[model samples]
Target: MNLGVLKDRIFGTAPTVALIVCAVMATDYLVNIVLLNTPNAYTPVSTLLIALVVAAPLSYWLTSQRQRLERLRDDLSASLDAKQEAIEEADRRRGEAEEAERLYRLLSDNLTDHVALWSPKGERVYSSPSIQRITGYTLDEFMALPPQAMVSEADFARVQKLIRGLTPGGPPATADYECTRKDGTLIWLESAYSLLGDGSGILLVTSRDITERKQLELDIAKALELAETASAAKSDFLANMTHELRTPLTAIIGFAEVLRRSRGLSQTAARQVGHILDASNTLLSVVNDVLDFSRLEAGGLELDPAPFDPAAMASSCAALVEERAVAKGLVIKVKASKGLRPMNLDGPRLSQVLLNFLSNAVKFTAHGSITVALSQKVEGDAALLRGAVTDTGIGIAPEHLDNIFDRFSQADAAVSRRFGGTGLGLAISRRIVERMEGQIGVDSVEGRGSTFWFEVRGPLAELAAPEEEAAPLLDGEGGVRLLLVEDNAVNRELIKTMLEPFGVDVETANDGVAGVEAMRQGHFDLVLMDVQMPVMDGLTATREIRAMEGARGAATPIVAMTANVLPEQIANCLAAGMDDHLGKPINPTKLLETVARWSGRTHTA
Candidate 1:
């Protein structure tokens, strides 16, 4: 407490009390001198009375005054103490505020990030020294310019809009924009903003340069574009190569089958023929796997769904691998559930999937039985069909089962060597089943056996009648004329030889130009048209033939023969007015069936 004022006031009272006591002493001395001059008798009585009256009253007055002075001093000291405490508290708070401001400047001035404060009216109030480092401008230089000097014209409107949208004490907002540095170079910036208010409200902006990040993003985009282009180029190269490859494989397999069935061969020679047939078939599977995987990866193949007998589908696919199973000393069986029904499905693709499972079973099993079963349950007239191919062969290991459906993956490298395969059959089957909206999986015990299964949920519908196979025609059936239009000499000769056994008249045209000319002069039951040729392509020829309606034009059936098996390619063929299509490496059975289907000529070609 501050006692200076109260102490001074108390000391002044002490002097006044001393003066009052002196006045009383002076009066007593004067009265004693007067008594000496007057009569001695009067002096004793008058002096005694004077002493009682003056001394008593004067003492009482002095005591009362002293007490009042003491009380006044106490009150003044309390008031002084309260005023002193207020002054000290104010000084401490000011020191703390100054220290806080010093610390804030210390951190922000050293930052790499740009920091700035603006008044509520959008005028710059404060800018950290870091702004000079980022923009190459001195503090005075920047402060001398207009508020919008550093802002980009392109982003000017957006910046104003964002600032105007901010609310006091609301969550911070972030923005990215372009700005000009002092050197006139444009740079990108991402900034976080908040409206700050500490009595005086202001806006705070913290920004970081993002020019490097933007450039990196651009570089990545360009690289991805180039990669996509390369991927597409690879797909095209593989597609063209596959077409060329299939052409020769068709001839190899076709001739081998004919040779294997030759008349009067010795047993040893027949066995040698069997080996050639088996090897050719194996090569064909490998080629098919590579091509199919390519198509699936490119998403060029699509499922064609239709109503097919579930039981018949399973039986037919099982039949494909039955001979191989029997040769391996394995028994094969087919089973259908009691209430199995025809379901809408991609018949050819489903059969291909089932064939993959059954063939794998046959190849792996040696002495045990292979069973193919189709179980079904009805759901409101639609049915859920589950097809399973179980083989009593060496089972897959537990660890390998997880990745079994991955492309080009096998149980192990040794298993791949022991079991000769391209390792793509299961992968292809999985893709086919998944694209059909079905699920496929496997269950097995090591050293026991394995069961591969698939389930398809679809509605029951009327199954189309099975297509009749191409049978050798008798002479009495009347000769049906066929115009075979192909560009390759080898293919022409092979087709002619393949069709010789059937009692049909066959004529050849070198290309579409010749085929069109030939068709005008001849009445043909069917025209086997190839897509690519010299002079004119098959699509143009077919359209041109349709244009001619005189002798053998619109009424004659035209079937496309080519190795372009993509659905889009087939669609293009049909869009060009061809009635049907057949992909190569042509199955002899399919070739004959296709011929019989359209031409009504039961010739095995």
Candidate 2:
């Protein structure tokens, strides 16, 4: 708009424009003079001058405009290309971000576990859709809860402490808690918490339902408790049953032996008495077998070993079974090694095993002889003793051989019924043998016979002298004062009868209460106390008596004479201040032997 700036721009192109006009005019003059021959001043020059002034300036202006337009077009194309490139780069980044989001959703949505993100302020921010499956709560519902809603008030503080203690890339802490579901049902959840705040300011939590596992653990604990209680009950039942059975068995066996030994019956009456004694002895053996098996099963059975002659024990067992063998029209031969020395072994248990074999032999053998053999071999400072009972009988079937020693098992159920056995003898014997560090086994053919054998290691005793013969009740023992305390009337009368024959001045008391009163009133040299009585037990009365008369009680012997005859039962008697134990079904000889050993001094008779 300024005239001077306009003149500067217009005048800047004036000279170039004038020079083009002059050149064109001169060329036109020449062309008119030389070629066209129109050299007249007004003809060619006039036209040239006109063309120069108008067309030449116009061409220059148009040319300048065309160059400007071309440059503008090039710049416009470059700007469009740069814009397209930027838009394409933005689209690529957005696609990648969407793909990442899809992958995250795929992993989190399909899992059974609840995956969640919580703000550092303890607010639930993002929850995986699987939260619905695990907790019955949708993502929206979870997020809408209070910041600490994931944990109960009881657990909120603990969760907060756990969250605060988390460090980036450190081990995650795990804990289990009771959680409430959307339906208000209680469930257990095990959760792992991690600090995902390695730039992203949130805590990561992964959780799973664990209610069933907790239930399983609780169930297992109850099952174990029940099993232990059942085992204890079985042991108690076996112990009580043993005591009951032995009490009656003592009276039957003891009185039957008394009648048999007294020899006061007519010949026919004596035969019947013999039958009674035989039946009673068989019943006693059966009872003893059952008791042994029960104690072995309950782990209450133990061995008591002492110095004894092996040959003598086996011979004694053989002698007992010989009568049965003879009654059945069978011969029983006893073969014993003369070289047998005294050995520290459980003589009673050893005798039990041999008697079981002999009894079976006598029972099963119809016509052929039964052989009882005892032998010994020397080991290093020890003796390996072997005993065998062989019989020619309806032999066991090969299939039944292995199971014969199993409790309640026999060759057949028919065999058990016909033989009238509880099928416990061999089993009890096997356990007894194994406890002594011995082996018991059988070998047989179906029709010929069976042989049962056992071998045990024994410590040789220093002396091989035979058991001292039971001397007759000496003159000094004739007036030995004895107190018999028993609850059962039959037991008391039997004890009195057996002791009175031996010249013992025996007085009886019905129970421990009476016995204690009698002890206080009298000065008996020995008290034969019965255990398990009413009003007061023998153990309690013993303690009371010991306290009542200190030095005199110590000097006076108290012996336990009860049906409870296990070694532990005897040990209990001793522990209760009793001087000795005598298991009942009292044989007259043993009662007298115990009497002589305790009160009656052995004089040179």
Candidate 3:
């Protein structure tokens, strides 16, 4: 391809051809001269004839040699041109490869992930500049030592073993190990490696520092364990306290019921009995809230969505708190939007939220009015039904506003002491509201009133025909049979007393063994089975009952009554054939509702 080579090829061929022509000419000349000398003919004609012969052949040969040399030079030129093109192509490819390497190096230096190549002898041959960023080590520092020196001493042998087992054509290998930094701090890394065979004494390695990712995983694991531990402790406490508290609660409610049913009771005594019942009910609410909040915080609460009359639900919630408001001489009002439709909502959870707001309002307000308003608001393409609970209660300070919905957070510590609460009501309410894809917030001014509101979307049917109200079913007469399987005697009595007013005929079992026995002998409409009972738990009993043959096989619905109210716990119960789940310190309304729904009867108080 060089011009010098082309010139050399051309000139070398010319000289060879010229030399051959000269040799042929000289030979002809010598032969003529020798012949003339031998014949004694030194005449000018002979000399002229010989000179002519030599000149014709020599000129012809020289001309022919020159043409051949030119042909050879042309062929050589074509070959040189091809070689030049090939050389240029090779140069272009080399430049491209160099550029690619430059870009690769740039990326490797800037990337956060660590990159390095290890030799088959377990030495680091090349490590990117990112080593400084990831491990506080310069490239020189890393290159000065074996790759294993950066690995934790505990993992060095394992890493060596892994390297030794690698084969050139084998599948890629991966490992997670801790590497020591320059400061002696260890960082977790996830490494993926493949062998690159170049007949060179080196292997390619790539690793990523996964310290944050690994820490997150560990945190999650620890959180789950902590949750489980707290759940167990709360469950045990609830079990023991439910038993202890229910004993007194049973006596109080039972005595009041007996007094109400008795003849010739004094007016003062009757009023006192009513007060006792009301106080007991309030205490029961507090207990239920504590248990419910614990379960909700522990991620045990769940929503059961169903179609219900939106107006009716709102009216009922307002009515439940209306008597309490009236007793305090406070004005209470409810406004239902026209043409309100049926909605799919978790009635119990929604009611809980409403009741908590009402209770808080009643506790804080000494005068003025409380209003619960329901109306439809149009946002974008969707219709949202907004429900607001506005109250003339002591307003929250601006500084405390943001934390009002946090668990155990109150406007002031005095609020907890004055208004007895677990400080979990708003937190639970917020969780329920958010879970339903709704929003909850408060509007308040200090020394004025506070308005707590929440909004949830309702079905279009209810939105269109708002006047319709679902009539409350008449209470069923005759005693309803209930089988209560609980280990604690006090809990058993409390449940029995609460149900007795609805004419519930109760049967009890101390544990799963007795519960199974009771089930075989009696035909009860419902079974409240407590989990974590001695001699077998509720889940096992439910399974056994489900496995029964004939009419007794999984017929009667079993509702789980346990302190373990986590989502997974509920799923486990259901999987074991439990029809429903209820947390401890169970709400009487919830129990009645579950009974009414499952027993195909209405409950009245």
Candidate 4:
């Protein structure tokens, strides 16, 4: 409303007004002055006024419409950009989902284990392509069959119970089931069932074929059974053969011992009897070696630990070989560490090992000394006892040392022929050491000498009380009343002759049946029962005698005198109520001691 604002507004539209005026003047000139020859009706002012009226309204409307159109175009472009960005994001998400689907199919289709998905109602929802390979059925065919159709009748109930116990989010259940294929062939399947953890009550199952593994297990079981049978048969054969062999050796050695004790005999006859005794003893040693090796091989040589003096055992073994050493003009000595205490060890078995070492040393050494050394050391609540037999003569070669402890192996064929051994001594010794959880080896140089050594660990044990000296085998008042039950006539006679000299009143029985009748009819201080007899075996007769003496009569002591000396056979005799066991090829001293100990009286007059 001010003068300056009015002037500015009026001048701003002056150019539009001037241009319109010029256009109006030009039109008037063309129409009236040139063609009609008429004079202009208005001046420049009037034309200018006419032009301003039209230009002002038109410029105002056009400026307002241009701003509104620009704002509309900007809004449309912004909306289009946002839509394009949203479209791009959607495409990327779609690609990711499609790739994941492809991977899922790739793994499920290629797996060897059959996979299945089931709904809560037990309806099949999906099956992997591996179903055909596992069950010989296409996915569609498998889905059509009931779940029980594929499972064998024997396993279907178990499978149902497992499925019924499944819970969402619980641990998977696994079991082996026998299933039938489409062709009705039976196969084993180790299957796992897991309930889906999504709370949808869906089930997932996986299974793998195990038919070949099952068959392998069955074959292994059969092989083990056959091995056990063969082992038992070998044991029986060995027992029988030992009985047959020792039955004769008993008569040979027993009669020889009797002859050697005869009051009047020439030097030639006495020397000949000595030879027979030596030969028989050597054969007995070989038989013992064989039986021991068999026991070791069968994993049945258990250790019986008791308190024993290692040094005394070593000295005893050396003494047993003293005559042989002296005959060869070889000096022998026992070197025992002073103050070596008693230890819990298998004394008999340890003695066997020591004897084997000393025997070998005396056999191989020609003119040098043999020393048996025993030492002991303490190690943290346990003691290590070591026994070494060192000899100076022919030694083992280096290569032979590696396999010298192997069963039935010798230094060489020449050594075996010259030394005359069955090559089982060192092997048996090695096994004995191993069973004691100990070590055994030899230090030797081909011809200079050999030293055999063994180290065993055991706890310190209390020494047992000394035993009383055995009484003489004759009583002044009355002789021992003993029944000799033996099937072999020569063996019976040999035993009778051996005992009669000491005043034993021997009652003879041909078999176990007669022995049992003899026990029922007469009172004998002891009975010497031989196994493998006719009519009845020793074990059966002993059992009958024990049963008959139930709460009514005195239980007579019966000793098993047979070559059936295997540990099991000894156990059977004890189980049948025998008081003691005396293996065949019996020693006179052992027989005398056994009778005296059980009779509780001397027989010497």
Best by lDDT: 4
Show pairs that collide, candidate 4.
474-602, 474-603, 474-604, 475-602, 475-603, 475-604
Q: Candidate 3's C-alpha lDDT?
A: 0.76
Q: Give the clash total for candidate 1.
A: 0
How much lDDT does each candidate structure score? 0.80, 0.81, 0.76, 0.87
Q: What does the lDDT read for residue 484 in candidate 2?
A: 90
Candidate 1 regions off by >4 Å? 1-83, 117-126, 132-188, 192-205, 219-223, 254-278, 294-308, 325-331, 341-350, 365-369, 376-386, 390-419, 430-487, 492-560, 567-581, 592-605
Per-residue CA lDDT of model 4 for 265-339, tens digit only, reads 899999999899888889999999998998898888999999998888987898899998998999999999998
In order of listing, the candidates' clash counts read: 0, 0, 8, 6
Off by over 4 Å in 2: 1-214, 217-221, 299-309, 326-332, 336-348, 375-385, 434-439, 456-476, 547-556, 565-575, 600-605
Model 1: lowest-lDDT 10 consecutive positions:
596-605
Q: Which lDDT tens digits does candidate 1 get at residues 1-605?
A: 25865565455455555555556555655665564554333444455566556655565556557767887899889888988988888888888888998998888788889888888887889887887887788888877778678786767778778878888888888888877899999888888888875646799999888889977887999998998898778877776776787778777777766677778788888888888879878987888899888888877667777888888888888778878888899998998888677888788888988999998888777678999999988899777889999999888999999998899988899889998898999999999989988999999887778999999888888866776655443343436678999898778877776666765567999899999999888778889998878899999999888778534323577899887766667898999878899987777777766765656432221
TM-score, per-candidate, Cα-based: 0.66, 0.66, 0.59, 0.81
- Scanning candidate 3 in windows of ten residues, the lowest lDDT window is 465-474
After superposing candidate 4, which stretches have Cα over 4 Å from the reference?
Answer: 1-86, 263-266, 378-382, 469-478, 600-605
Give the deviation of candidate 3 from the true structure as CA RMSD: 10.6
Ranking by lDDT: 4, 2, 1, 3
**Error of model 3, residue 155, in angstroms:** 12
